[model samples]
Target: MALLDELAAREAAMRWLDERTQLGTQTVTQPDVANFPFNGQTVALLLRQQGICKPRQLDAALSIRTTWTPPGGKPPYEDVEGPDGLVRYAYRGTDPDFPDNRALRRAFEHQLPLVWFVAVAQGVYLAQYPVYVVGDEPENLRVALALGNQQRWLGVPGPDEVDRRRTVERLTKLRLHQPVFRAQVLGAYERSCAMCRLKHVELLDAAHIIPDGKERGTPIVPNGLSLCSIHHRAFDANVLGVRPDYKIAVRRDILEEIDGPMLKHGLQAMDGVSLTLPKQRAQHPDRERVKERYEEFLAVG
Candidate 1:
């Protein structure tokens, strides 16, 4: 009878998941799960025992909690993935109500991906992953309650095996490269877009002077340029080119074409302008790398 009852309960939980998942749209954490995924290890343990340990948190996005508090709750620390691909989420052990420690452990043990939400002035930002939990404990150097792991979001089914493999590979590469690259490049550029000086970090992207897969292409800052999203796209698509001398050049065909406000001002108008550079000479884009990429651009043009 107890086994039957447990089976019935499991069926109920599965039913809840089915009812909550939107059939047409992407899967997100249902309100109940997202609102308070885990309050502490006890809550997390209870959820896991009840067969509710895993619910997709939208895209499994990861986020760093900021100093800004939400209306009622304090924020969690930003999780950091190290150069070796190990992720560490630190927490102060003082708060018993802080459920992240247990939650992280459960996710690791079960091999489930978890979503991290960070509170900010505007709203919450999130990071998610199928991280392989390496266990949680205290560290001496930067000692705190830490949950460490490597991100490996590969288990979920995709359109097919090839697509799944490709997606996972790309995600792994970005996990290893993007954050460090962005941080170094943005710091050098003082967090502004190099092309148009757009100041928002969210609007900025670190673009490679030499494309990432090329012979000399690397993730170092000297080979990076912080550009706004639009300009990054333009730079990548060959609509905009940066010369060895750091001048901006629009493709001749794009400059010659008549277009609307976006093209007229955003792209063509910026032609022949010198790039806004980092104040620190050491952080400046390497001219040799720029020359190599420019040669490619000229060849395409």
Candidate 2:
């Protein structure tokens, strides 16, 4: 089992590296020789040294390595020689002031893929912020300054675009549905309606205790509840609510004025019954958020 797990990990790494290298090739035009030093041959050689043969295995390993790197600190940069004994490219620290020696040391310590991803992500991040080039302008410095100027005009840092891309990548890995609020709520509820235990994904909705439109961007799961259409509408309109302790409640006004066996069976009968919980214990709604909603429900006119 241990050997199998190790093999699986290696395979995953190979896949990740292949995809990332492809993405880098597609996205980075005339990438700084200092930043992307490894050519195809160099990458192949490195993978061989690490005992990785398959592209898929290389990618998976690189993905894990990239994701695990520390969030902050100067990125690693260095120069690598091609098979022809020519300097193919140089890896430069993302921060111009970052000492190349220290950065390279850290890169070697953690491995190149980790450093590469950090630099790529950081470069995308820094592209968003204002860039000011200082000191007597050498030719290369002047080029960087010109790029910064163009970045400002083009909104090159494009934080929103970068964030969206990162979000998609991360969420994809987690297998999360788009429109995260609903996905998160449904995920917690295992795609079943809390009120009816209806497993029909299409019939269920991720109802917010405080309607999202009203909640002003607070989309925490504790502020959410899973309900079928009828129950969700009822709860949203204040005809039904749940206490912090999980006890169901129906407004006296709704119970008195409504007359139907369906209501009695579906809504009123649910009174005093507890909500179905998530399969995983950790996915349960936060107690504090639930309590706050419960209190607000009580205070509503």
Candidate 3:
């Protein structure tokens, strides 16, 4: 009799879900039956089926609990209430679980769409946010999840392009600032400065090929060049430049100057040299991005 009652309950649950489900075009994936705490995991799977596949392209961060948790037993990722009557997600410091967060951060850096699914007693509510990793504070690394204003985009049926564009810009401005972005870019360059081949982890930075504010700029490894702090600054300030052909160039005025060993070897010696590229050709600096930034450097010089 107990077995029959359990079966009946499962049937009722499936029927309730099926009525509200927006089934995937390719396959109708059903929920897991045997697993305990099935609802939250089930909602996550349904979200995956509802077009959040390809971690490199699209993703969703899910939480069965109302708040997100951080690593090292830190406080839960916070929700800051706004005057606009919406709650925004925020996290600070290194997520000790960074490896697990790679896919989600990759999606954010590329301006790829992502959703958040939280399982509630009634069902699941899907939310979208313009995710960003703001630079660190004295206490911790800061990340923000502003409401993306993407109703239809997150599978909520609505229309508002103005808000969508604004949200996108807000998220795109800090591609280089995120820990995940740094991890990926540094990983691609083998944790060495691409220009100087500096191997010290503390000295290296994930330098963007183009400034983050530019339309074409992104945190993708192909758009990044691992550079040490000084060289990274030089690259950004147009003191050093990289051509699309993978050759390096120091500003002509700086190169011609007679200076001490530091200036001579540090900057001028690298002039007309080839960059140390990633082993994978795909991870090599994007030629178009190099061309764009190189042109800007030439214009400034």
Candidate 4:
């Protein structure tokens, strides 16, 4: 193998080792454009495992451009053919000697400074591949790779920034809908609970306005209510609802029962209370859905 190819192989090996070690498993095959999707963090993990801990090494790796194409037909761009007649792709700069080659290289030489960009972008693209069957667009792949890389690097928040990056990456894959829902609800509720005025993030739950299993579609902002756990469970179980006018309501019987004082003191006090309007009014729950849910709650008891 050439020097750059040797480096790339070593980097790939190191990454596999790192993953194996971290996972407490034996050595496995390296991640690549084929078996395991390649990204910046994967490259970085490999480099770090191999003791190439300098940013310069990362920069060099990021500068490489690997070949990617559809299963059949010519690539959208030109590629340089090797002795074996297969097009060779490098992660580094385009082969300066073959200026006329149709091979399109994903630009990374100037964009490497945005650390983890490769991994994040590639990871997202890879994740969507099964669903969307993303095609090989060099530029889009570059962006996806970079984004996936950066996201992976920022996995989790901790003493080690790398760990934090990794955590974020994993979370991104697992709960893709969470951030969108949280942003929408928080924006709608002005970052406070509509019921308890709970502004602290740790104390809040993005309670689904309509339960997930109840024909409510996804847990989007329009289908969500910002509530503390107490209120969230109550809302889910039909103990609470929001009127079409955005006023809170409690089940009448729950409020009137002889043993209702607890519900009254704890939840009934919220009845008729105006919603804590969101800063971005556009994010507020749809009145129609809320009204429908309210009607449903009324029928339950």
Candidate 5:
């Protein structure tokens, strides 16, 4: 019995993901996971029957997936992203010694990277790669994963390491978490723009009501809006905003400006329109955050 080279597998996974991203694919499908090329041959990155994927030739777990819970529903197991930015994944069925769990533990011990397929919708997933199983917490029946180069900063650090850790945190949010955030927010709105109800997933994005740099501006469903790329850019630039009551508001100057069809129809036409929110009230954008953002829009206008 032989295992595939861990480094080669990780490189292949990254290459596969890069190709997908370049093609504007925001979500990974079952077929995408099933027929990936590895080691000059086709290998399944995930299996249909298991969330923890370790192919016969793989010594370490290839990937672990988590599903999106329906609105107001509980997940089979709780996987949490902590304040320190590490994501904790529960072991299989409360058994830290389970084969899948042991493989994950081995991944940590061997410093091998694994893919974490985070569900953006019921069947749609966002693939995050090069995440190392950094901690094997047998006591808690879970393992901790660090994205990209984040594991480098897990231990006690010097002042420079502290700054580097902050950089990694920011990059993790940008390169890894941002896509997951997009998937979750867009999925929450059923892949439609909240303002215009545009349904093109390729053009959609999760806009922050309060920018992520702010203390209270965490990237969660309550703080995000499903917007098309144009609307997203407009919102970010204060050209558009949503009032606390969920009314679309284009900046006064932009509304009155005679620019182009995109401005008149895309932005101005949306002014005074009621925003289309997620059906589940709990998933709606935070009113206070919207108000604060709208105020900034007002100040700019």
Candidate 6:
């Protein structure tokens, strides 16, 4: 019945999460979270019923979570990024003085890091760690969290203001939208590659049909494809492409090249093969975007 000290528990929990998360390729299931080893006892890494979790055993807040929002629904907490590139997390409840909110405030004051569990599906989460509370806005009853220490170098927002703004946008897209995009895409396609049907979740990625940097490249399910690492790289490099009709196309040079079995079976064989889409019709890739990309693929070759 021994409990781990505050720092020990946070560190241990992060190590446990790292084992499960696979550097953003994989997700942590509720079962894994529930069975977290704390000292000699098993403790849940996240709160099951609430978004903000601060178990009595720990002095500061342990984790904050946002559960799966049904299609067309909004998340309980709107974690928006400010102009400074920091992600703002809302207070636990409407009340500004909730104990959980207080715990999170304490973590910010002490410079302690906390885990943020973003749900990809029911009972499944993508864990982002070492999240520091860099800004506390009591007027809004929310705290701003930063994933990178770039804020230290940027400093006080003066001469480099435009550069700072651009940096903020880029950081927001990468740190927040990227992970959620990957999670949603992978989840939509049932964690299998659309081109090859590969089932290694840890080796799979969410490939954007429309590049995320483009104005039209929204991080939504229809604009993404679940792909294995190899396929994702190939797609990005224009070595392979998918037509609007859902057929795959490997670049002519690649198909004709004499290479290892990986080329023959992996890329060439997938040519002209129709994409295996998600079971749910709503999760299917957008045909118009697919066509636009396919036209690029054609012109490049």
Q: Evaluated with TM-score, which candidate comes out highest?
A: 6
Candidate 2 CA-lDDT value: 0.43
Residues 84-107 of candidate 4: C-alpha lDDT, one tens digit per residue: 211223222234323211111212
Runs of candidate 1 exceeding 4 Å displacement? 1-170
Off by over 4 Å in 3: 1-177
lDDT of 5: 0.79
- Residue-wise C-alpha lDDT for candidate 2, range 2-56, written one tens digit per residue: 3343344434433544454442221111132112112232232122112112232
Candidate No. with top lDDT: 6
Every model: Cα RMSD to truth: 11.1, 15.1, 17.5, 15.3, 3.5, 3.1
lDDT (tens digit, per residue) of candidate 6 on 1-301: 1223777888888888777776545777766675578778776567768877777667778788878887788887777777666678899877778898988887877766788888877788988877777777888989887664554244324445787767766766777679888888989898899999999877999999999779778899999999999999999999999988899998999988999999899999999999999888878998889999999999887
Comparing 1 and 2 on TM-score, the stronger one: 1
Model 4: weakest 10-residue lDDT segment is 125-134
User: For model 1, what is the C-alpha lDDT against the true structure?
Assistant: 0.55
**What TM-score does candidate 3 reach?**
0.47
In angstroms, the error of model 6 at 110 is 1.0
Residue-level lDDT of model 5, residues 113-150, one tens digit each, is: 78788887777888877678877778888877777664
| Per-candidate total of colliding backbone pairs | 9, 25, 1, 41, 0, 0
Model 1 worst lDDT run, 10 consecutive residues: 42-51
What lDDT would each prediction earn against the true structure?
0.55, 0.43, 0.52, 0.46, 0.79, 0.81
What does candidate 3's lDDT look like per residue over 213-235, in tens digits?
A: 67977666788888999899999
The better candidate by lDDT, 2 or 5, is 5
TM per candidate: 0.51, 0.43, 0.47, 0.47, 0.80, 0.87
Q: Which candidate would rank higher by lDDT, 5 or 6?
A: 6
Better of 1 and 6 by TM-score: 6
lDDT of 2 at 23: 23
